[model samples]
Target chain A: MADAVSTPQEIETELRKVLSYLTGNADLIHADANKPFKELGIDSMMAIEIMAALEKELKIQLQERDLAKFTSIKETVETLLTYVR
Target chain B: MQALKLNKHEILKHVPHRPPFLFIDRVVDLRPGKSIQALFYLDPAADYFQGHFPNHHVMPGSLMLEALAQATCVLFDITYPSKRKRRFYAGSVKARFLKVVQPGCELELNSKVISMVSKGGVYDVWASINGMDVLRGEMGCMCVYE
Candidate 1:
């Protein structure tokens, strides 16, 4: 289970790790968190990969509607916060 | 869930593909909204064999993916009956080809939904020959209402 007190910053950090691994772009840690995934070189397929990876790492289930909501890291972190216990 | 089988005639009603382009011949097992197992016969005289390799003919890898995609479409149709009118559009796919598929082989296609929403979903799909794994991958698809 994720830490109940996990802050958005913490979630963002974890998300950066996942994105870096999936895209093989280590600089994502420093990249603008608000940048859209498309501008960051992530496509729809990669988005699905990210979602699947997050589900496994966080031990959470994301709904289908959440797939289209993966616009940016900041936005994704906020969405994840709602699901994380 | 209990497995439901569909013959070629029944499969035609659910799948829109036709001869030459149609990869699946019959569905052996189906669990709506979850998973499906189908089969395809790789005929030796298929037109692609004439140039695919000349004397050493082999089924193209892309077609294998198409077969998997078609199976996924069938699963989606059965899973969401209300969305039967919608067309399935394959979005993105990540696949690994483990073995070469040859002519006259019976391809066992299988697909399982990993995640689904009202409009689309992601699926895990694979195909095998004589129980030997040939290809496996993850595919994303959308149901186009148009």
Candidate 2:
């Protein structure tokens, strides 16, 4: 479970791992984290998948409205932090 | 939260699928917007078995996935009765075939809504024969309003 002590960098690393695995882009961790997922070739379906994966990994629950926050790596980490914190 | 059960005939009303293409035979349990449990009988004489294999017939894995998807559609229709007219399309699926399903096997299909999205939702689906796991996976479904 992701606790309050979890840092932004840790969350970012996990998010990058998920993005790289889902998008098959190995350079995701080193690329611009602020790039929009659409620009990174992530579609609506993939967005849904990322949310599902994160919820399972972090042992947290995210609502439908949070789907939009998955636009970029940084945004996703922030959204996840709100729950963990 | 009472368990809703639907027979073969009643199942048709909730989904647009018909014979041949229809994979679900009956819905054993359903919780609108939450989860669903259905069944399908793999008839040995089914057309697909003829070409799928002549000597040894095995239920196509894709059809099993389709059955799970159809079950999700039924759950969706019941959850939102007003959207019954809409079409349910499965956008993405990640599945693992654990066992070989042969003809005459009674497929027990189960799916649970993982989360609701803008267009549809994500679901965790699995199937078993005689309590033995055959397939397990997650899929995304979109309710396309026509």
- The parts of candidate 2 lying over 4 Å away from their true place are A1-5, B80-85
TM-score of each: 0.84, 0.88
lDDT of 1 by residue, A10-47 (tens): 78888898899878899998889889999999887677
RMSD of every candidate to native, in Å, equals 3.0, 2.2
Identify the runs in model 1 with alpha carbons over 4 angstroms from their true place.
A1-7, A20-27, A36-49, B83-85
Residue pairs with colliding backbones in model 2 are none
Per-prediction DockQ scores? 0.39, 0.57
The best candidate by lDDT is 2
Query: What C-alpha lDDT values do all the predictions have?
Result: 0.84, 0.87
Best by DockQ: 2
